[model samples]
Target: MNEQTKKQYTMAVLNLLQPKIASLVKEAHPVYQEDLEQELKLKMLEKMQTPFLHNIPSFFEFVSSNEKK
Candidate 1:
């Protein structure tokens, strides 16, 4: 992808993660929230960059399932 498209894709993923990120922050201890948030962002970006798509879950779906636990 071009630089602009890559950035747009990243931002789109980030936007989709906002609500889940907020939920995770509230669910986590305040002291660890920043670290957890950063980790989640890294994970989301990593998942986005991967080319394979055989059994991968949608980002929000994964977040929702995690939220349930």
Candidate 2:
């Protein structure tokens, strides 16, 4: 897909998945649930702002590089 479409799809998937993830996290930890959700939302927004087109590496490459770091 084109860059715009890719970004939109990425966001759509994140939107769909985030609530389920947040729910699970909240269920696991009853305290500070709202804070966790807010923190996760902010982090997601920060990650989404970084374009994934030019600098994104393969999954294995990313994992290995992070391991090295």
Largest TM-score belongs to which candidate? Answer: 1
Report the C-alpha lDDT of model 1 over 23-56, residue by residue, as the tens digit. Answer: 9788999999999998999988888777784357
Lowest-sum lDDT 10-residue window in model 2: 45-54
Flag regions of model 2 displaced more than 4 Å: 1-14, 53-69
Give me the displacement of residue 3 in model 1, in angstroms. 1.9
Evaluate model 2: give its lDDT: 0.76
Candidate 1 stretches with Cα past 4 Å from truth are 53-69
* Predicted candidate 2 versus true structure: per-residue lDDT over 1-69, tens digit per residue: 598997797679678978686776767567778777777777776776676754789899999999998
Error of 1 at 53 (Å): 5.1
Q: Clash totals for all models, in order? A: 0, 0
Question: Considering every candidate listed, which one attains the maximal lDDT?
Answer: 1
Per-model CA lDDT versus the true structure: 0.86, 0.76
Give the range of the ten consecutive residues with the poorest summed lDDT in model 1: 47-56
Each prediction's TM-score versus the true structure? 0.68, 0.45
